[model samples]
Target: MKKDITIPVITDVYVAVVNEYNDIYKTQDWNAYIINDKDVDLDMVIIVTDGYSEKKMTSVFRKKLDVLPKKSYAKIELMQEDLFALNNRFKVSFFEGNTMYDKTYVFRKNTINLKALQNIPLMEAKGVLVK
Candidate 1:
């Protein structure tokens, strides 16, 4: 029975953390973005995010979008510097046409620092990408 079920593979979609200037606070803040690199659009996009560690955890945050167009990206959340000490996770789910797909991406504790920043697809800003 298990062999009969086909699980779709998720590709070209990713969650990243970028450092950007905040207009309101006039500060450089760490922000999360959902990047869609596929040729098709993603519908009913839902992302649940949280940060945790050995003895502590942050509140879970949920963000929804009607659609994410092809080769584009959307901002999900702003992460504080303190949360960088915890392992941050992003569970993303969406529909590509009639099929639904989901995947979890994680940024391990203490690994989101400046050294990890690199070229991200479809975005000029460099950031840490989950493989």
Candidate 2:
């Protein structure tokens, strides 16, 4: 029954796009990161990334992590500047103990620019976050 179902509220988890200096290229690059700000560890983390618009679409990308420790982060992918024009989505799923949780984070079209940068919690650097 609907009344008996439990829907967990996801908090403290976030997807952020940070612009950092690339040592090999000697240039700034945009990268995606998954931040786990929760107090407990998360297990079996899976993230699916995709992007689309009316006239264009991107290939689906998947990333997996065995465990994400408390108050830590992992780099998901290197986001190209071209992706900024499309609506990007990141679907995250993971487990806390015996319970499973999932959520989707989206960065709307043209929303990943410098104008949208902010202080990303736990990551010390500034970037665009979809919480």
TM-score winner: 2
Candidate 1 lDDT over 1-131, as tens digits, reads: 99999999999999989887779989988889999999999999999999999999999999999999999999999888899899999999999999999899999999888888898889989888885
Q: How much is the lDDT of residue 62 in candidate 1?
A: 99
Quote the positional error of residue 111 for candidate 1 in Å.
Answer: 1.0
Per-residue alpha-carbon lDDT of candidate 2 for residues 43-114, written as tens digits (9 for 90 to 100):
999999999999999999999999999999999999999999999999999999999999999999999998
Top candidate (lDDT): 2
- Show model 1 residue runs off by greater than 4 Å: none
Q: Indicate the TM-score of model 2.
A: 0.97
lDDT score for residue 49 of model 2: 100
lDDT of 2 at 118: 93
